[model samples]
Target chain A: SQQGEEDPQALSIQEGENATMNCSYKTSINNLQWYRQNSGRGLVHLILIRSNEREKHSGRLRVTLDTSKKSSSLLITASRAADTASYFCATERGGGTSYGKLTFGQGTILTVHP
Target chain B: EPEVTQTPSHQVTQMGQEVILRCVPISNHLYFYWYRQILGQKVEFLVSFYNNEISEKSEIFDDQFSVERPDGSNFTLKIRSTKLEDSAMYFCASSGGFEKLFFGSGTQLSVL
Candidate 1:
């Protein structure tokens, strides 16, 4: 399977603490995206980092990609209870008719207690 | 902000029955896609449509599955015969290019 794997299948933290998750992929990719899915809800796009990018930030969320390691990490600063959800990393391959056809990772489930 | 929209949030169907899940992608987006997630499984891409044609599809998308842009605004996925394994949460996503995707609240399909 071309799917990626995320580390730390589950995490729990108190509100205001930072939460971090890691993802590793096997193939060359054009870009990697992070998405959040609340329980029984649709995925909400969080951020996207291209293969050439090393780090990116959106609000309190920070994403870092290391091509040499074929891995990426997502950090949510000052996490709140509302930040509790399953986070997934999806990689878009480079070749073929790769029009946003993403291979998703086994997500990391995060729980932030208030 | 524009967003993708899917109809029939939940559908319970019997085996061998045909089912069509509907989606209305963002108006300005040019690409549409279908993805599925079985309970606790990673999201898997099924097919992608662009310019009213299928641009990419996964092996999981077999002959029994079909996609259509019936009108200018809607995209639909049709499964000829439902199977127990077909039960999953189907998500419809649209993208302007490749930056980020807008996803709709998925349709939970339960096949019995």
Candidate 2:
């Protein structure tokens, strides 16, 4: 069973617009990470925010974490057609020695038009 | 600049046959993992390998499944008897630590 669930199953935006996607999980987590998958080929690691940290940024991506609510959001600013893809949020739980075994959400498909 | 690599981007195996999907993780990575995604489904964790032994696995990883690091570099997932249900894209991942993991291009397994 998957623990994480992403909101907005699909989104379409114009170029240069900002896109936001939300994710919610059911259990305590050590950290939350967001990933982007293009054409269902391979996933690219975007950003990771730990439980202690409230926010993180990398290039044009910004991620916010709320441990108390067990939710996180990813904001992509100045979106381009190249940003069209499926975005997923995966949670890392604590107390498990099998690290990096992520429970992923049913990703959000984002499409940016020119 | 290093990343995990998977061979035979696509594999078609017959039912009840044995199939071994191979992966080569990053050189310095200590932890390795396998994940599968059926079309239009969330990526599911199968198993994790570290220190040359199986560390942990999900319920999906059953007796029919096994993982082995045949060499210092290659990690392989073997299905003793292939089933149509096993058809999916299998991804190999590696990480230096528990926080971040880099994934491979993934091998699409098609069971006929």
Tell me, per candidate, how large a share of the native contacts it keeps. 0.81, 0.84
Colliding pairs, model 2 = none
**Tens-digit per-residue lDDT, B1-112, candidate 2:** 8989998799999999999999999999999999999998999999989899998999999999999998999999999999999999999999998478899999999999
Candidate 1, A26-89: lDDT as tens digits: 8888999999999999999999999999999999999999999999999999999999999999
* lDDT (10s digit) by residue, model 2, range A36-77: 999957888999999899999899999999988889999999
Residues B1-112, model 1: lDDT tens digits: 8878998999999999999999999998998999999998899999998888999999999999999999989999999999999999999999998568899999999999
Predicted structure 1, TM vs. truth: 0.98
TM-score of each: 0.98, 0.98
Task: Tell how far residue B85 is off in model 1, in angstroms.
Answer: 0.7
DockQ of 2: 0.84
Q: What is the lDDT of candidate 1?
A: 0.94
